[model samples]
Target: MGDIEPGALVLRRAEPADRTALAGTDPIAAAGDPTRRASIRRWCEQGLALLAEDSRGPVGYGVLEYTFFEQGFLTLLTVVPGARRQGVATRLLTAVEAACTTPKLFTSTNVSNQPMQQLLLKSGWRPAGLVHGLDEGDPELFYLCPSENLSLSSTLRTFPDTVIGKESRI
Candidate 1:
């Protein structure tokens, strides 16, 4: 599929039946990795997966879990190469945020993944922290999307003084 019309995309909770199609949408998963496939299956089984489809079929999927600091955490957000840069990831992220049950939703990407970092910032996610050693030279950059119920002051207090300042986006 080429650039998809935003109106044509449908977002829904992923099911076991969607595992194959979902995996097909991600290059890493489509490459036939057992671990990635199993992880997708587990996300579906736990009702933590959301799928984005158009008339063509499954185009993207996202996984959100409340396993980080007892808050919502977006573990995966993948879109097929053909269907990217057309708001598919944004829609998935919005759905995940709406489905989140906690006061804050968190997600992280490798520092080198500038595209994802840009998307997160553009979509209203604030920089939370940076973690090193996970991938050697490529550090992980964390982001936070606090719910309406969460106050900015509380969120700022949660991070180090250096992470939050007058110039901070949060």
Candidate 2:
């Protein structure tokens, strides 16, 4: 409803107990897509999901996995419509990047998703390439954020010595 202060939000690895709240924020999952729900569960189980929460509840979640040619790939990033443009995606992305285990983290969004492209660019992710036929008309644009580019100071500044569970707050 109101602007959410970035510092007021908590970013941590998603757990089994978080599946329902995480799915509720996802449009597809909320719409009763069983496949999407299953994917969310799998991501959480595999330790590849990050959840963003404020006092209100779960606002966003991200999934990063090494399924893309053995390198890190951000397969999903979902922020509730109400939470969209308030830095939740950025925080989720930064946390995903921090959790990346490979040298290069890659992600792609449909060309029609301009907001995502802008977010990736502003967050220091560079355009890697583009591929057609992924979404029929709208091409998929790939972006990359190399591990070397992730400075230690950026992570420290974002989290500010916060750790909420077995996982350190990102």
Best by lDDT: 2
Residues 1-170, model 1: lDDT tens digits: 88887467777778888998988987888999999999999988877898888888999999989889898899989888888889988877777776676778899999999889999989878999999999999999999985552354343422111212322111
Off by over 4 Å in 1: 149-170
User: Which candidate number maximizes TM-score?
Assistant: 2
Model 2: pairs clashing at backbone N, Cα or C within 3 Å = none
Per-residue alpha-carbon lDDT of candidate 2 for residues 72-109, written as tens digits (9 for 90 to 100):
89999989888888988987887877777567789999
lDDT of each model, Cα atoms only? Answer: 0.79, 0.81
Which lDDT value does model 1 have at 23?
A: 87
Tell me the spans in candidate 2 whose CA falls farther than 4 Å from its real position.
151-170
RMSD of 2: 3.0
Model 2, residue 169: C-alpha shift (Å):
6.5
